[model samples]
Target: MDKRVTYCTDLEKSVIMSNFERRGWIQVGPEDEWNFYWSFTQNCRNIFSIDNGYRMNDNQIINHFPNHYEISRKDLLVKNIKRYRKELEKEGNPLAEKMEVVLPSGQVATRYVHLDIIPVTYVLPADYNMFVEEYRKSPQSTWIMKPCGKSQGTGIFLINKLSKLKKWSREAKIPFHPQLSSKESYVISRYIDNPLLIGGKKFDLRLYLLVTSFRPLKAYLFKHGFCRFCTVKYDTSVTELDNMYVHLTNVSVQRHGVEYNSLHGGKMSVQNFRLYLEGTRGRSVTEKLFADMHWLIVHSLKAVAPVMANDRHCFECYGYDIIIDNTLKPWLVEVNASPSLQSTTHNDRILKYKLIDNIISVVVPPDGIPDARWNKIPSVEALGDFEVLIDEELMEKEENGCRPTKNSRYR
Candidate 1:
């Protein structure tokens, strides 16, 4: 049997197994902890998809792209965008609103640190101080810091201070924030204290949105994605939300909760949440959340439109994380390019499988559909024509640092 790779942790692997009989795909199992063995063949071609470990779709997105690769990751969400553009408006940028926060008072706090440099594709420091500053100025400064390269909320830390970061780094005897010369820390963003209400608890909405086209950009929300419940009251008192033990936006983490195994007792899926939102909460609030989510994607895409492909097969999909405030106001949290395909529960598997299935169905078309898959399609124009003169190494340095390229010298 021909085989292609799908990688996930053990917990998620078991969940993926549930879909094998229904999705028409065989689960080649009995593998290592994270190895997902599967017989996958496309066009009679015996191609293999190997995910050595967690790196999101960075490898997949690049390996499939012929030669011209782009750099529009966390690097583009730098502090300088504030100076270039007023307010946290998403005119079409991918990381808008989520990375940029407009407080209830209208103060714009960006998750970026340096307003001067953006790493396009090279390695650089990921800044958290900008987020620190934004937090300090906000009515609710408590925030979450994330490593740019982590997914499944693996490296997310709910922190409360600059001193705590330094002290913790010192305890580890490793460089984190203050020791910036060698720190591999995350881009700190002001954490939202007011998570949207769900059954009187804090929860985040995970909308599965895809950017089918970057140029003349096209976007749409998945019919179903799901919500993440923190299993605790919505409190930003540091002592409360500080516990990643309880306040994670990841289903992988929450599903592992002591109560997850109970009968719909732990978390709620998108189906239930939508129904609840429409009935109990009213459709107006539900529509408001989607409206805000659409607004964020539409504008964020516009900001980065200058540096992507417009071909039918070339696409960049995003798993957007959003939190709605008490007043039913939606605030974007972060955008995951390669969201965790690793489902933690039966419901999780069902939603993500359908989402991934739709993605593959669109990208990997069967016979008559014509390979309209984004990566399989050719670029609308030559890469050289639209390519910018950005420095690869320097760009990587800044982007890896999680700072946007603000210094025009590199551009």
Candidate 2:
């Protein structure tokens, strides 16, 4: 039997630990020698964190870790969206042509990028003035303002007028409050207005993405994700604009809704959503739509793969939120590094429980020991609901004349 200690600190992460113990893996204290270590914050000595942001010391220690997961850097993720228009413009990818937007320089930007997937976002303080000029062109357009580092629907609001920003700027002064400092400055993006509605409500997809390696860029998209529905019906009327329950699909915000369902948890299974779309849009169209979503995800990972400081021992499961428009095109909203594992309802508990279990199965060996160097492509059966997007080991196997079986499951 394999014998290697695994460590995790967050009590809320006990779901993961419970499964680890069930697998007969020994759990060790912080000071003990361990093969797998999980924490919320990165440790230089030998640790992995759920967070993506890191310090220089963390990077320096990263190289020495026999196995370590790279923390998702928030600044880097912000930059990915902020500079996406520019980068895709330079590359001239066809995807860019789809996201057409006229630059302030009068340069027509073709890259509707993800259409409604990613709201046209600009990094504030740096891009604030530029966005202001763009907004002046259409002051009636609604925009969502969000703080870079905060989560759980915190520091988010919608604005349809430029005067509010101007007023905030005037009061806070040009320097902006340290609370709203450039690092913490709000990422203001054009709000997605006409979302694909179900029962006349706005909703977004919360899909899980697991990354076992970054350099090789192996990822998996969970098929059994869910849709977060806003409790209030979506409306564009001026009076309803500030109603977060109508505008936001975040469960954290939706729970406060008087109409929120305790049984359904304001969520629907992704399978059910797929079935609904298939019934309405036809099978071929639905399949292609999901395939396109997969495409967007792979490329997004590629965009940040180079800058990701990866360690062999590290693995991460990201919560990716995507929104679809009336045209059935999926838009990238945001990627959450540490998605809440809390189970607010029975359905939520079951899905999250299975999610943690499957993740453990994919990353940990049968003997309960983690072999960081065993970096082979995971079998689909081991992945449960997830499908591999990019696997370097698979490529290596193919190059060496070892093709996977015809019945092999990979998407």
Candidate 3:
């Protein structure tokens, strides 16, 4: 009997298709009987929708959760994190510690220092009055506005004055109303004007996280993530605010700039970035920075685990975009459900190919079969370039003073 696993993918990308083919997995159409489906977010939604009535067998698995938007959507993500911090604070958790934050206008304000990983953000229209109140607190501060449903830096702009949002208020129509409207919504965040610049250019970290489950939360962080750099030099001047090349580090947007370097795709390996930080900022600070990043990543996942669908048959590889300020403080920008698999350069293609390969090895069982009911743990060898970010089961054992088995030391 042929025991080969059959797989199907809606994405025609070489990185994804090549990985499946390399695994000797048989290709099948979406409508065909397949044990694995590397589907788009839209297809995943359709499959899990009650109206569709599509059901997965015990031996089948897919690439996304049914309700990933609880953490992926910009506005929803902020809302969930805010709620998470409040709950922690109510419980008197140390993670919810508050501290003084010095504003741009030299005013000191108390904020949830530990839990304030992301920028001070508010969902637009509904929070318009609150945003106005905060805006008045720091009139000189710059804020960035982004459409909740859009990505790839499509509808992003920086504003220092309330007058700049007049057009948006007019479009939203329900300005300052407490009731949420059905119109296109947005999230405005205080911009990180003093970003940590390397070679006089601004950049952001693009880290990949693989989540196998959310309930007994299991997650892995890929070690080969990279930094995306803006094509133009870093500038905070109002004149340069309109130039995306100077502000945004997204490859899709940067590729259009004249100075865009096709050879390197304007990206630097995370390893190289760490080395640079270690050299300039010292090793201890660099280590602490990374440790804090991991802490934030785990907490961010924890923030949404309660609301996540936590489907057993689904695993998602999330792209975490982070920006570090000049003070060496890393801020969570947003999370992407479907991170771009499109390769920009030769090295990029190689990195993504290996990423897909490792993802398959971790998600699939040892017998080269996709089994949703199997224990979600993968051996260290199977993990490849991925490291365990969190395993709640192991955590629970540790909390109860139970020693983890030798094989379970992957964390």
Q: Estimate each model's TM-score.
A: 0.60, 0.83, 0.96
Q: Could you tell which candidate, 1 or 3, scores higher by TM-score?
A: 3
Per residue, candidate 3 scores C-alpha lDDT tens digits across 1-411 of 758789999999999988888878889998999999999999999999999999899889999999999989999999999999999899988878999888867877779867779999999878888898889889999899999999999989888889878876766574656575656788999999999999999999999999999989999999999999998999888898788899888999999999989999999999999999999999999998998788789889989999999889999999999999999999999999999999999999999999999999999988889998888889999999999989887677776787765324323
The residue-level lDDT of candidate 1 at 118 comes to: 24
Candidate number achieving the greatest TM-score relative to the actual structure: 3
Q: For residue 384, give model 3's deviation from the true position in Å.
A: 0.3
Question: Between 1 and 2, whose lDDT is larger?
Answer: 2
Global lDDT of model 2: 0.70
Candidate 1's C-alpha runs over 4 A off are: 1-140, 172-180, 262-267, 309-313, 364-411
Q: Model 3: which residue pairs collide?
A: none
Best by lDDT: 3
lDDT of 2 by residue, 230-329 (tens): 9999999999978999989999999988999989899999999999999998999998888778867776676666667677666778888889988888
Order of candidate numbers by TM-score, starting with the best: 3, 2, 1
CA lDDT of each prediction against the hidden true structure:
0.49, 0.70, 0.90
Total clashes for model 2 = 19
